[model samples]
Target: MSLIPVDEALARLLGDVERLRTEYVALPDALGRVLAEPVTALRTHPPFDASAMDGYAVRASDIATVPTVLTVIGESAAGRRFIGHVDDGQAVRIFTGAPMPDGADTILIQENAERAGDMITAMEVVAKGRHIRGAGLDFRQGEPLLEPGRRIDPAALALIAAADLTQVPVVRRPRVGIIATGDELVEPGRLRTDDQIVASNNFGIAGIVHEGGGEPVDFGIVPDDEFAIGETLDRAMAGGCDIVVTLGGASVGDHDLTAKVFAAKSIDLAFWKIAMRPGKPIMAGRRGDTRFLGLPGNPVSAMVCAHLFLRPLVARMLGTSTTTNIWRARLATPMAANEQRQDYVRAIARNVPDGIVVEPMSVQDSSMLKSLAMANALILRPPHAPAASKGDVCDIVVLRHIT
Candidate 1:
């Protein structure tokens, strides 16, 4: 089979995918979830004309001049309204957030007025509507506060609550099942022989799943046997997993059994090879309603593929937008011409006096997990690109958000 470009592979993988179902969750628990429907204001904010500052509610004409004396009628604190009206030379002591008393059109801040027994003398001139928050100043009833497909961040949660919504309609999070294959692989903290290596791709992939808003269900390590791999895949399907991610055992090598097992289980294999460095052997397919992704056993390869493909898939299922987080940066090191496969060069990015500068690691091996860990960005190099020198502009995908 011919190799598929990275972009084409992703297009095919997500071509038929759709957003999952919606569920109602409490506002407090809606953080980081995507809104399934728009949230409209249940009632107008500041439902009544309220005070915006601690001051005396007086008729604008009463305080049009400095040092004007007015009789204090009653006090209006938050949650308590002054029943009396401010007529002519009368005023009402009002606190912030308190409703304005009847017949009051302006507020004279306490600092601008001197208070005595049942009386206040305006010390400065004031205009109409000063310090008064009109009804629906922030939002009006039936107005849309948030739209669908919007992620509920801290600010969004506060806005939704302010809209008088105790419960929010949000898209249900996708559940992903992770299966690691290889007889030579063992769980972390377990004793390993000279021929065995601790399995780490599952943990890393699980973290990616969580960060992408999906629940991860680990199936443990399955040996190279075909039956064991098939059984685990069946169990994951039976468990109602939306996506099934298999690490290692995807290549055409004699020991690679993931492809054969998936085919034996009647999986509609989509594609197997991609035109990308460190992740060329990645495979994608579907069995029933569960999506399957087969990643290379190399630690760095699996992570790079996950960031490029799996993250977007999970986000799509959650009804949220996915971003590449790509930024422009100046290359701090020289690079040779790229081959047919696109390269994701792990690099360190730093903000300098001029601009953001990125330096790719000297070693670009697929199995080097330490280098991947130390990297803060991935310098993107397109296939068949010409050689580049230091100080050249390049595209970089940020791994962590910088302040």
Candidate 2:
């Protein structure tokens, strides 16, 4: 029952995800993986100096003096370029995205020009290089655009396509195993007595694993016997999982045998019992290459610990280095005091005129999963803190949508 500071516990959990490995994936499959190397521009954008509007390309000197007129020599549409250069006192009728002819230095927008037969008049003065997209304005050839460890998003994928890249080097997803322990827990569809509870925490943890970019292998529920716990863990480790999460029995109850099983399996305890509410029984260790996490039985405690621990581990596994400790808007309603441990209170965020408004969920029992279902954020209450008034800002955790 040793107590440890939250910051110190987090510090020991640092490093690359369980293991880092690189793989070549197509652009479409690189959605959330980290970029192993920087992406470079293959060619200059706009290729050549081009018009930015549907107007006339002319020498600035010809239109600088307001109310100037010039004869239209040629036309340049999108696919068509006016090969001939513009001579003095002459202009080229060019559409947007069309390359500027050799002798043109500026473009007068169509709204500012009046046409009379083949000649046009500028109603206002125009400056040099106006309404023109210079070569490589968007991107330059040989420029490093994206760096390693950067997560790939839709915009980034489009940028890679624009750079003419078909494949990218990204970190691979790690496989994780989840096990729930307790005689009181039964399978989702199993026949149960009133005293038996549903084994829902593993499913919640599996969804969390998927959200964190890892493949979850659920081992169902293991009984309270030490042999049953050991059997479940042995299977997970032998199955080659990168991380193993065993829910419940992390506390020192008569039936709490997760720690004893871990010792038998040669797990080296990294740290346990953080100074946080709901998850004070969290036990972290390592056995061989597999990272071990033993969480408490209460539903909210297990899930919140998963958000704080497992999610980050998977992100690191994918070389993302993403930090999930997030922000929450000031509370619109007051909250109660906290005990000696940090408490995570589930809350909902709403849109308001000034900014997002946060409201704590009415039912905050540690054993209730329904409260977390309607929650968008979790408000933090520091140890030994008194009750808070409305408008008090606090730390939060944003739960991502699980696919």
Scored by lDDT, the top model is 1
Of candidate 2, the 10-residue stretch with the lowest lDDT total is 394-403
What are the TM-scores, per candidate, against the unseen true structure?
0.97, 0.83
Candidate 1 overall lDDT versus native: 0.92
State the C-alpha lDDT per candidate: 0.92, 0.86
As a whole number from 0 to 100, the lDDT of residue 256 in candidate 1 is: 95
The candidate scoring highest on TM-score is: 1
The TM-score of candidate 1 is: 0.97
**Full-model lDDT, candidate 2:** 0.86
> Residue 17 error for model 2, in Å?
5.5
